[model samples]
Target: MDPVARQTLLAAMDAGWADPRRLYAEASTARRLLDQAREVLAQGLGVRPSEVAFAPDGPTAVRWAMEGLLHAARRRGARTVASAVEHSAVLAPGRHRATTAGDPSLFVEVPVQPSGALDLPAWNAALQVPGTVAAALQQANGEVGTMQPLEDAWDACRRAGVPLVVDAQACLGRTGAPTSYDVLAGDAQSWAGPGGLGILVVPEGTRWALPGPPDPDGALSGPTRHTPWVPLALAAAEAWQQTGATLDADAREATALVDALRAAAAALPDTEVVGDPVDRLPHIVTFSALYADGEAIVREFDRRGFAVASGSACTASTLEPSHVLAAMGALTHGNVRVTLPLLRVAGGRSEDVARFAEAIPAVVAAVRAEVGAPRW
Candidate 1:
């Protein structure tokens, strides 16, 4: 979290400790804070305050958003169309829903180009499928940082009479909120806010419903089964304000740094830098080195005092091959993913990226040498 956001969070802990559902004075104060937080987030996202709903986290927000759309459209069609490179949160639930319904065709996974951009023709064709009730495409690929053709996809979905749910968790604060989505999902953590807070926007007139049975308190459609923690909401609001204030400047610097890192990685022997170089996230870069183990590369980078990630960005803890890379026909092994922090945040500066770029060639060589892999 940003230092200022952290202080705001800590201060909120004292001010918003009461449950907002109660009718006490402290509860009223907490309720006011929560409402204020929603307004802040809505303003930042360019949506109405009534359109916004909170979630426990980003993945949950995505899953709920997709499921809600699917449920609402169930009478019209049972199918959901999404790009193959969608985050696991979107893909996993989609697959599960298809499996549970005993219909493989219920979820259609459209392919992407090698640059990790969705295949526009394939996407349009998928939406044209008879049973597609909803379509999903991220504003940007979380794993490789490739920007999707959101406007085109939105137009296609509109023509097909399908609602589009955009997972903008990766682009929210870093790039800016996307305007093309019928339903937009984002994470507070993406903008220097604390984790455990997710944002969902459902514009007025969008066909959406809570996926499960009705809640007595009508709370299931909101952040959690109950009211969200007031302190976290306030902290997220503060983070959004702070991050948005410096977004343009921070993105400019991060773009230059990421470009340098991409060049360094691309220059390494047998290494392939993935994603669209110019039409991608400003702060993320991923590269794969042939014949090198991803974990070994991560460890080598860690030993050199730089934290990095490998395998699937969403499922890194499981060390699974990246489905995103596989969909893009890119090497999945020995991959290193870097997401630069905002320049205003600690350990986020030009110097940090420079040091990491300086070490890339040696790190790749050292890892490949240990694995006894040819560098050709």
Candidate 2:
């Protein structure tokens, strides 16, 4: 979190600790702060405040968004369509729904191009697959940073009368909020806000319903499953304001740094830099080195005072091969992913990225050598 956002969070913790559901004076104050926070987020997202709802976190919001649509359209169809590279949050529930229904066809996994961009023709055909109730596509790929063709995808969904649930979790703070989704989901942490806060926006007339049992207060009809913590909401709102104030400048710096990193990785022997170089996220870069171990590469970077990610972007803890890379036909092993922090955050300067770039070649060589992989 940025220093100012952290300070705001600390201040809000003291000022908005009361439960807003109560009718007491302190509760009223807390309620006011929560409402103000909602409005701020709505304005930042370019949506109506009434359309915004909070979730426990980003993945939950995504699950709710997709599940809600599927639940509402149960009679119409059980089928759901999503790109193969969608975050595990979207794909896991999708596969579960299909598995539980005893029909694999209930989930349609569309393929992507080598650049990590969706195959538009395949996406269009999939949407037309008779029973698709909802379709999900991230605004950008989190692991490889490839931006999807949202407008084209949304148009196809519209033609097929399927609701589009966009997991904007990766692009919300970095690339700006998306305007083409029927339901939008994002994480607060993406924008330098504290974690545990997820943003869900269901525009009016979106035809969505809560997937589970009704809220005791009949509040499940709203966007959120539960009331968000007032302090976290306020802190998120502050972070949004701070990020929005500096979004363009921060993106330019990140873009340059990522470009440098990408160039360095691409120059290394048998290493493939993934994602669309020109149409991708400004701050994320991923590269795969043949015959090297992803975990070993991560350890080397960590020892060099630079933290990095490896394996699947979502399933890294399990050391699973990246479905994103697999779908893109890229190398799945020895992958390193970097997501630069927001400029206002610590370790986000140009010098930090430069140092990392300078170490990439040696790190890859050292890892490959240890594994007895021949140099090109």
Candidate 3:
């Protein structure tokens, strides 16, 4: 999170510490802030405040969206369809639902291109399947920074008479939300807001419903049990506000940084840049270095004061390849994922990229040498 937004959240906590569901004066104040936060996010996303619902976090929002839409679709004897590259949050619920229901075929997983973009033909074909009830596809992949074809996916779902849930967790405040979407899920943390807050948009007449058991009010809605934490909501709103007017500049700056990283891959032997090089999230770049283990590379970067991440299973004790990288047909070993801070992007700076470009080659070389692997 950025310093300004961090302070905003701290200030909100001071004022919104009270329960917003109550009727007391203090509660009323909290309620107002909560509603204002919701309105702010709604305005940013081009939706009605009434259509916005709160989730405790992004994964919960994904689950709620998948379950609610699938349940509604099941009323029409429809099943679930999603991309094979969706985050575990989107994939897990359907697996669990199918396991409990004793039918493994309740869900259909669409394949994707090696670029991490969904195969348009496969996506459309999946939706056209007679019983496809709910279709889930992300606006972009968080791990690889690949952007999906939202408009085409939306069109296919519309033709199939299915509700499409677009997971905007990676692109929400940082990029414009797609108008073609029926349901959208976003994470506050993606926009430098408090970690636990998530936003779910169920636009009017979308036909979503909670899976089982209704609350006393005769409705099941967002993942939260009671009123959402007002402070986090306010913080999320403030963070979203901070993104205004700077989105384009940030995109340009971050894209340049990512492009620089892509260029560096050529200088570093046994390394390959992953994702759709041109059509990707601006702030993220991922690459894999052969022979070096993911965990060791991450540690080396950390020791050099560069906080980078890796998707390769080699980092974990279990040593499983990243599902995302596997789906993209990319190398899974010695992977590194770098996400630039929002401030750097907003400021139109590339000094951070220069530092990374210098550090990465040395770091990878050292790790490979230590591992007794072939060198460039």
Task: List the pairs of residues colliding in candidate 1.
Answer: 54-223
Encode model 1's per-residue lDDT on 1-376: one tens digit a residue: 8778899899999999998878999988988888899899889988877788988898888888887787788788889999999988989988998999999998999999999898999998888889888888999988789999999999999998889999999988899789998899888999999989988998988888875566564432352343568889899999999999999988998899999999999888788999999999999999998988788888889999998977644336665688888899998888999988887686547888888999998888887889899635
TM-score winner between 1 and 2, please give it: 2
Q: Tens-digit lDDT track for model 2 on 179-199?
A: 998999999999999999988
RMSD, model 1, all Cα superposed?
Answer: 2.1
Q: What value does the lDDT take at residue 290 in candidate 2?
A: 92
* lDDT pick, better of 1 and 2: 2
Instruction: Give model 1's clash tally.
Output: 1
User: What CA RMSD would candidate 3 show?
Assistant: 2.3
Span of ten consecutive residues with least summed lDDT in model 2: 216-225
Model 2 misses residue 195 by how many Å? 0.4
Worst 10 residues of 1 by lDDT: 217-226
Candidate closest to the true structure, highest TM-score:
2
lDDT digits (tens) for residues 111-224 of candidate 3: 899999999999888788776789899999998999999999999889888889999889876677778788888888888778998778888889887756655522223333
RMSD per candidate (Å) reads 2.1, 1.9, 2.3
The list of candidate 2 runs beyond 4 A from truth reads 212-221, 312-319
Please report, in order, the local distance difference test score of every candidate based on alpha carbons. Answer: 0.86, 0.89, 0.82
